[model samples]
Target chain A: MGELRLMKGNEAIAEAAIRAGCDGYFGYPITPQSEILEYLMAEKPYEKTGMVVLQAESEVASINMVYGGAGAGKMVMTTSSSPGVSLMQEGISYIAGAELPALLVNINRGGPGLGTIQPSQADYWQSTKGGGHGDYHLLVLAPASVQEMSDFVKLGFDLAFKYRNPVIIHSDGAIGQMMEKVVLFDPIPRRTDDEIKKQCPWATVGKTPDRKRSIITSLELDPGKQEQVNLRLQAKYRKMEAEEVRYEEIACDDAEYIFVAFGTSARICQKSIELARAKGYKVGLFRPITLYPFPVNPLRELSTKIKGILVVEMNAGQMIEDVKLAVSCSLKVEHYGRFGGIIPTPEEVTENLISKVIGG
Target chain B: MTEEIIIAGFGGQGVLSMGKILAYSGVMQNKEVSWMPSYGPEMRGGTANVTVIISDERISSPILNAYDTAIILNQQSLDKFESKVKPGGMLIFDPNGITRLPARKDITIYSIAAADEAGKLGILKVFNMIVLGGFLKLKPLVAPEFIHKGLEKSLPARHHKLIPDNEKAIEVGKDLIQPFTPAD
Candidate 1:
């Protein structure tokens, strides 16, 4: 373990990206997540690790900068909130189509055109099911705590490079604004030019004298070739689904009822689980760590053992669709959520579960 | 034992910083701690608040509907958080901005002249530390030594020289607490 410090999640993401040897960070300042860029600018990582930190004029330019940097085989990233993320969707689609490896963080606020700056999980469908155009998938990781906020940056980058895909850290204002004690990892050195050239042979890092020039693009004028490309992307997504289904089961053993949630909602559900259990109700929490992979197997298996699964979110029933697909209607699957940035309290969640799921 | 506290006041009054310092002090003692603030527009010198949780074991949630302690610095905070404190919990307030006393029979209420003491000390910035000192004197979850260390760790190096004045304000605040004993 390295030094332990109490830091906010947004600030921790900035520090962790620097420590992870990220080559570049391009982002516009947005509420709830502006601290990420602010911390990076204050630290001046360029002085220490020679990392480039640029405040783009807009989220569109910022994500395109990520595309340009990542195409050159550099570990680049961008951060934004919901409205800003909506602006970056076009650039994100282009990055995904080009199969560029980069990290995109969404410190989610309430959505649908600048709804509010309060915390929300309404971007579940946008993050996991492809916020951008085309039939594609982003590797999404939901971090519930400040510690996980720091830890997931490295993990997101590693998985991005491993799969040659864009990875999204699906965080919300609750996790981004909250402060907790986190043990940061030891600094990892940036990948050298030689390493980048060897690992990402498809990188457009100027033509080599001995080899053919590498062209980084997503354009396929021929319809058949585009179909083939889509198939390849689908195969890659399947491989990810099979290999990277991550989740956490809290008190799931011998549970009669379970709450399915992710990101900030999962932490809220943890408290609800405690309250319900205190009232002699056998409740547990099934938290999906990787939102994209969805962790269908464990949920499918648990559906048989528990009486029912209640999907709780900060949105009005998005992940419930995924949970329903996972359970296949073997047991009752219901959703209870508070929309428009209204986070449901533990007592409310417990009361709703008792009246809605348990009573029904 | 776990202590969940809500500290609320005007944004410039260091409401969030007080919670942060207490959380840092808890971390210094190797305890699990979390600090969550009411961010965004609500923090623009309006009513701002933060929830700080310190526990011997891992803290399950940082958000809570009720808290064991409520440290209120303004009348709006008093009106908002007076009922949020659990029964048998403690409610500490600075009487400078409050026109009415905290009205609750189940919870214990105490008044600290934090703003006035800071005014007397000729530094308005030490008001939060004074209230923090009152809380620490009453609860003693983290020691004064750890709080001093927490000040060193939480403050920027450029502002570290002001720690002594803040310490003096805290000491003054420790001596000026007026416990509001409820009539039986």
Candidate 2:
């Protein structure tokens, strides 16, 4: 077992990326996520771990750098907050169009246009629906705790490489600044160098003396080729949807009401469950670990037993739509959440449960 | 048995540290616990708050809409959350920070002079410490010794001297709050 220590969400992010064997980090400084950069700057892992850490002129350059590294099939990642994430959308789409594999972390803040610097989950559509453009998707993983924050680096990169697509670690500022005790992994089994070389043959590291030239371009004038490319990516997404969807079920066996939430919001919903159960209500919580490959079958099954489903979040009920789509009317599903940087307490959630589920 | 609560106040009021002590005590007692904070600009010297949920079960969803109990250290928080308190919920407030309240009389509100208490103790910074003490007395969530250990772990090495004073503040805060239905 690894040693446990107190760390902030951003520090955990930095350490987890290093532990996950990410080959490089190219990012610009942004609020809420600046600590991620600070952490990397202090660690200087490039010197010891042989990882390249570059402070780019802007998010554009950083994500482009990621594209460059990823074009060669190396594990690369970048971090940014809301506004900076908006700027990187173009690069993200480019990476997706080229079928490059990489990871991105967005420490979300309230925004329509630089709205505020408070925590928010408003980027759900932006992240899950391909914030950039075109018919594309990214595997989005939402974490609620520092421990999970540390683990997502490994999960995001693995999924990205496994699917030959980009993956996103979408967290709020709350998760970034939070201080908690985290047990970091030590010497976990890693992908072998030979495996990486095989997986990324199209990577753009200059061709060796005798090796064939590799090109990592997304442009294809032939419509047939573009269609074929999209079909391949779609097939991979389907596979992830079927096989990689993940979640945690709490007390749902005989639950009358189930509260659905993700990331930091899920932790409080759990408390609401316990509080409601004390008053003789059978409440459960289903926390989605994978936002994109949302665990659907389990939700369908639970919907049959529960009286109602409440999708709570820090946004204006972004994931609620997914829950409703998954259950498909087996149960009454609604949303009770906070937005514009306001977070609901357990008591308010308990009241929502009572008024909506218990009363309904 | 375990208890959970949220403490909220302005940035300088030390609400997060109060939750830290409670969580520390809970973990030391071999109970499962988690403490989460609201991040971003709101925490930069504005309204800083923390959620401490300790239990025997593997805790899920740290987000909460209601609190079993809460501590309010400023007028803004009282205005923000007085209505959200659970029916018959326990609320502890620094009387100096809050100037008003809701008309409903279900909650048990304790108005403490934590800042003044700390001032008397020669360390006004321990105001949140008193709130933790109040939490311990009111909820009995964990033993006092666990809190002392937690304080030891949470405090910076250089701030070690203040631990005893903070503990004293906790003792004082606990003594001031009224009892509640004991945890089973």
How does residue A143 of candidate 1 score in lDDT? 95
Per-residue lDDT of A1-360 in model 1, one digit per residue for the tens? 698999999999999999999999999999989999999999999999999999999999999999999999999999999999999998888889999999999998997888999999989899999998899999999999999999999999999999999999999999999999999999999989989988898898878785568878889999999999999999999999999989999999979999999888898899899899999999999999999999999899888889988899999899999999998988888889998878888889999899889998
Task: Provide the clashing-pair count of each candidate structure.
Answer: 0, 24
lDDT winner: 1
**Top-DockQ candidate index:** 1
Global CA lDDT computed for model 1: 0.92
**Can you give the DockQ of every candidate in the order shown?**
0.88, 0.43
What would the TM-scores of all predictions be? 0.98, 0.83
* TM-score of model number 1, chain B: 0.96
Candidate 2 positional error at A68, Å: 1.9
- Model 2 off-target regions past 4 Å? A42-44, A179-181, A187-199, A275-283, A304-308, A327-332, A347-360, B38-41, B44-47, B65-69, B72-149, B157-184
The 10-residue segment with the lowest total lDDT in model 2 chain A: A187-196
lDDT per residue for candidate 2 within A106-145, as digits (tens), equals 9998887887777889999999988998888999999888
